[model samples]
Target: MNAAPADQIRLLDVQALDVRLSQLAHKRKSLPEHAEIDSLTKDLLQLRDLLVAAQTQESDTAREQTKAEQDVDQVRQRAVRDQQRLDSGAVSSPKDLENLQREIVSLAKRQGDLEDIVLDVMERRESLQERVGELTERVTSVQAKADIATARRDSATQELDDEAAAATKEREAVSAVIPADLLKLYEKLRVQQGGVGAARLFQRRCEGCQLELNITEVNAVRAAPRDTVMRCENCRRILVRTPESGL
Candidate 1:
């Protein structure tokens, strides 16, 4: 197949844009902002889970404190009634009075023990509530950071996409001037050659393979017409010769 000399040059332009497009795509995937967003997202999920556990602990502890407080109130009310009975002088017998006083003392001790238990429950509830609050704040902070990272990542991706789009338009413009057969062959070769189907023959070297041509290969290429679309024997890449080809 043969294409005009100028058309072969346009193929090089298309190749350059294709290489840039590949680089842009790679950049989009490998952005550090993307990694940061992923890490923040995971951390946010774990923090939210911890917050749920903490809230449950706080709620359970509060319920325990409520029950303990009710027990304290009930014991105190019993002690009050016993004291009132003792002061009313309703038990005139010494033995009965002495027994009544002893009962009051026992009730007081029991009330003190119940109050202590209530205090302990209250303390535990307070501590758990505090932990829940802390975790909630951490979750909020992580969510904010994740939002910022997402915005930055999205902005970066858009910029790369726009640039790649422009390069693609430029590639299409160059493709329009080249022969359909030549373009098809280049596309087919690109699929098999890691996206590089054509390369310049510069400084006596096939730029695709970066290898110097043998004498026989060099002579054959030199004798070919300027419009002939040629392939490098070393790399099988289409070779577009320029003034520096060292023919």
Candidate 2:
């Protein structure tokens, strides 16, 4: 395929734009925030699990405390009724009075034990509450960091996307000027090779392959017509000649 010397130079501009787009894509993918967000997400998950467990324990302890307090109240009420009966002389028999007094003492001890249990349960609940609070704060802190990272990632991605969009537009405009056959050939070669479809021959070297052209290749290129489309023998990419091409 053949294109004018100027058209081949414009192809290089298209190639530059294509390379820029590729670099932007890579930058977007390799953004540091991506890894940061991933790490923060894992921490958040672990923290949330811990918070849930603590909260559950706290709730259970609260119910246990409530039950213990109820038992204490019930025992105290029974002791009050027994004391009233003994004071009213409702149990005339001396044995009955003694039994009533003994029952009152037992009820007091039971109430005291239940109260102790209630206190213990309250202490456990309080500790669990504190744990839940601490875990909640940790989760909040981690979530905030995650949010910031996501925002940074999104902002960086948007900037790169905008730049890539501009480069793509410019590439379309630049590539549009080339002959259809020549552009088609470049596109095919671009796919077959890496991202570089065309490279400049500079100072006797094919920049694509970074190798100096042999004497025979140099002579052949020197004799080629200015309007001829050239391909590098080493890399098989379109060899665009400029004044610096050292013949």
Q: What lDDT does candidate 2 reach at residue 217?
A: 96
User: Which is the leading candidate under lDDT?
Assistant: 2
Write out the backbone clash pairs for model 1.
none
lDDT of each: 0.90, 0.92
Candidate 2 on 1-247: residue-level lDDT in tens?
Answer: 6689999999899888988999999999999999999999999999999999999999998889888988998999999999999888779998988889999999988988888898889889999999999999999999999999999999999999999999989988888889998889889988888988999999999888899999999999999999999999999999999999998
What TM-score should be assigned to candidate 1?
Answer: 0.90
TM-score of each: 0.90, 0.96
lDDT of 1 by residue, 81-125 (tens): 878888887888999888888988888898899889988988888
Query: Considering only N, C-alpha and C atoms within 3 Å, which residue pairs clash in candidate 2?
Result: none
Q: Which regions of candidate 1 deviate over 4 angstroms?
A: 89-102
On TM-score, the leading prediction is 2
